[model samples]
Target: MLISMNTCSEISVVDCKETAEKLNNAKRYSTIIIVGRIAIEYIGRAVSYAPEGDRIVLLKPDGSLLVHESSKVEPLNWQPPKSISLFSCIENRLKVKSYRTNPHEELLIDFIKVDFIKICNIVTSKLLIMGKESDIVKLIVLNPSSILNASIVVGTDISTPYGKIDILLKDEKENLIIVEVKNEKAGISAILQLKRYLEYYASRGLSVRGVIVAPSLTDEAMAMIIREGIVYIGIDQLINGIKDIYRDIYSYTKFKT
Candidate 1:
């Protein structure tokens, strides 16, 4: 049977073990969604609430933290500091503390009661795929018929003021194309990010077009795509087309050393 700290008068040895197990898995997954009672204290502040109650907290790999009290879209508190502090478990309680030197600011969070924990591997995999999409986009851009006979003439994974473009290419017509790759569902935000890159290149007086490559797009995103006049390509098609070109090589190489 699972032991809950909420029902018990005090945290038990079993509860500590459970928290340890969840925290270990959370480290492996790189993100943790924890539901429990929590308290936040900002030390040495003139006016501070130091809220304490049942809350859902998200611990990210980059040391970002978010606390939510209700099902509202916005979080109760968000902290994405420059550096992430260490997390320690003491007396069956989890603690996180952050300190700043210049401003002399310190934040402390304590988890008094932990009811449930969820390791967010879905978003973790999406992040991994986001990194690989750069390579896949490069493979797709090299094919003649893939981008309407476009060939890559510039550096890939190009850095811009908005963000990094997954793959940059120039078509036979000498028009520059900005490609943004998303393995998961493409939403309006993704389109907006791609548009930022498009505008950046367009401002340089070059003939530029933006293309969003993703597995699928939301209905609202599709409407925006058409209205925005940006090109869209399904990742499945791009991958399968590349596989077709390299299938024989893979099959032939598999039997060899």
Candidate 2:
């Protein structure tokens, strides 16, 4: 005679291990283990067969494989202080050809695409310079909020005692940031125009902070700024400063996480 016992609780450790091993080996399907509860059931994945050339890959936390497709990425290339260089990084993933001859030019191109205004502001602070006037205008349009948020205001074709001011800004402290922007080298006329704006503001009992923005500055123009204690800005420096700010913010958040 034989007796049979049937109970769910009767399974031993050896039996559980054997069952698990069998299940794992049943098929070659990849396994993804979840620790604790999460909002999403599965994370996305991208796998690449080869590591050469341009490609995009989505990945899960674990090493387990998932779906993968091949696609080209763009290459970023440019000269230093160009301000549009940030696009090169994205371009690299797209397999785009780059013709930049030096690292600085390449970096400038990338910086422009990443954040033009910040680059412009930094240029102003550093007094380096920009190669083109259109580049400055493009930077302004790319980040209109920066101009809008300024302590001063800018009006188009505004009548001023010192010719027409391209842009004007007034702060809460009754301080004015007078601006004159040109697409080419700011000549002697640019300086004279700025002086008129300064005198206009001073006549109104407002302290003025003179700013001269041009695609490029002549030696005479730069010397004038130094002698008069006015501020001269270009595009690249602004972009670099913006990048630094972002890097700092990212570092802080990463540390907290």
User: TM-scores of all models?
Assistant: 0.42, 0.41
Candidate 1 root-mean-square deviation in Å = 12.8
**lDDT (Cα, 0-100) at 210 in candidate 1:** 83
Residue 152's lDDT within candidate 2 is 42
- Candidate 1: which stretches are off by over 4 Å? 1-131, 141-145, 243-257
Candidate 1 local Cα displacement, residue 146, angstroms: 2.3
Tens digits of per-residue lDDT for model 2 on 123-215?
Answer: 113553445655554554444323333354555446875577666666667566776778767877788788878888788887888877765
RMSD in order of candidates: 12.8, 20.7
Instruction: For model 1, name the residue pairs that clash.
Output: none
- Worst 10-residue lDDT window, candidate 1: 4-13
Superposed by TM-score, candidate 1 places the C-alpha of residue 191 at a distance from the truth, in angstroms, of 0.4
Worst 10 residues of 2 by lDDT: 114-123
Tens digits of per-residue lDDT, candidate 1, 1-257, equal 33323221222324665656556545443666778888887654433555679988776766667788878898776656453455568876877665555556556778787787666543434331434665666556566356555366466778998888887888778888887788788999999998889889889898988888888999988998898899988877776666665775566666562
